[model samples]
Target: MTALPRRGFLTLAGALALGVTGCQLSDPRITGGPTAPPPRPTPTPVPDIPGLEAALRHESDLAALGKQALAAADRLQLGAGQRAALGWMSRDHGVHLTALLAPHPAERPTSPPTPGPRFTPRPEPTSSATLAAAARDGAIRDLTGRLDAALVDYRASARGSRGQMALLWGSLAAYARAAQVALVRDAPRPDPLVVPVRELEPWSDAEAEQQVLRQMHALVYGYQAAIPWFRRPESQTAYDLLVHWRDLRDRVTRLLRDRGQTAPAAEAAYALPVQPTDRNTAAELLWRMEAAFIPFAGAWLAAATEDESRRMAAEALEEAARLCLEWGGPMTTWPGWPG
Candidate 1:
């Protein structure tokens, strides 16, 4: 299936990211042209997220300690198979945590609500929050077991289906754990289905394409997470980074095509049918919208005084941050923009 046109995809993504709206924001200057460039790195801006620096330090410490435990386990000369299993298990935990720490930025809106459809509301907060709140440090450790189980199942799956399936299960498991962490961390927990209007159902081809787009998005998110954070933002540096990211997505998509997958469709409607001036304005418009959406969700997540909201926010941010980081990488799968 062909990928959804870029602007439409972004529209959906923006809606998800903002947890609101459906209007398209294509600019007139887009020429639908493709350019080839090398992958460059963006100077990492200090995050505007509240307490982000401290959180990073805390995350770093935990990761270091986790690695140490895994190393020690290996030094004990545990049975090779057991050691291998544990190693994978440990890696899974790290991945899960990273995923939690940084999440996907693009969002898939839920199907629109049917006319007068029945909706079941979630129950009030439980005592678990109190317990978890008291044991914040240990909460993540406890959640690891869920991921471990999912990871084992994922690893044991048949090879052909494993990658995609592993991705799905792993994503859900990781998000769940992250949510648990958020609850303990006191982040907001707005209802997952809070969008005012119902989702619009698309064709089956659109769904298939959506999956591909998400996969491509995942590659970008991974890159963002793996790269060292940059702090400088000179034009030469910015352009170089943009070129690098642009090329990285094209390269990855090509690899996927060689493996028999089709690259995602470009945002056709957003692109100009012919050359026009002011392309930079068009690009900036989309980026600004995307930038705005991320923080909108963050605001929503940060607002809840209830335990559930806090937990949900923590979980959502983990994935959102991870995904953003991945996109920031040099190997992201989206061709046009650096971010």
Candidate 2:
């Protein structure tokens, strides 16, 4: 994959100023000059996260690339659906860049503002195949690699951060993973699939609900297998996984009952996608389980009619994405898409 060139852009900040003046009383009768107002408390400064600035720049570059890709797609006259999807993904990148660039309360202004360069837009491709080739060979590969780097940066930032910033950076990393998946799905692949495409098609509402139940049951079994590995005192990741999987199981159970269906009983044992010999392997296997659940979650999202059901499915999709990252799975572009 070709390396993305660094493009510099200006970092801007907004400032607020306050002015106060004391006035002398004209009358001697006034007991004393107006008492000075109590001093305003100063806000505690937020600490800087190392490499966060570089990560933000990288994300901004990604967003610029997305814009260029969208422009190329338009010039190439891609299908409306493809165009729309690309547009949405590009816009998402823009939003992420804005969030990353927004001034934090703890950020101090630079004396001499630094101006960054803009991305140079490439000429439009003449054919759809050319476009796909560019995406497959260039943009998608670059994005996946950069997303991995950005995830590392965000994880580091989260460690040094407190309160909402910590949560925000962590969530941003997950979003980057999802964006990587979207780019991969949009790109063309050379190989034929072993699994038939028809099998990946979206199911009817009833079918989707059933699939969700099956997935929930499988996850319950998978987590049960994983719990022993996570039972070590130092295994916070394992504990988190246990809690998440169990909560998902219960949520799915409630969903099933709400639909007037009985949730399937957990199996005595579930077949592992890959047999685990150690903690690392167990974590990998659990990650695969979550990856497998994504499609079902997507299907449920599509088939759900009620707002609550849809929200639940959305939450499931996001959680699965986050867990996949936690377990070192490659970023997926479309976790909720049936395809």
lDDT assessment of candidate 1 = 0.32
Top-scoring candidate (TM-score)? 2
lDDT string, candidate 1, 1-339, tens digits: 122223222211112222345556674564556676557666434233232233233323333433443455434333443333333333333333332233221122223222222221212222321213123235335435433443344323211122222222323333333333332232222212122322223223223333334333433332232223333343334355445445644653564476576666443233222121243332332232222223222332323233333333333333433333222211111111112
Please provide TM-scores, in order, for all candidate models, with all chains considered together: 0.28, 0.45
* Top-lDDT structure, candidate number: 2
How many clashes show up per model? 39, 8
lDDT of 2 by residue, 1-339 (tens): 111111011111222233545666864564667698678677445445566565656556665655666677645445444444455555545444444443441222212122223222222222221223254345456546766777777656645554334334544555666555545544322111122111234455556666777777777677667766654652666767667777877877777787788676666666677566678767777767776776666556556655566556656766776665466454433344332
Which 10 residues in a row give candidate 2 its minimum summed lDDT?
Answer: 2-11
lDDT for 206 in candidate 1 is 26
- The per-residue C-alpha lDDT of model 1 at residue 132 equals 31
What TM-score does candidate 2 get on C-alpha atoms? 0.45
Estimate every model's Cα lDDT from 0 to 1.
Answer: 0.32, 0.54
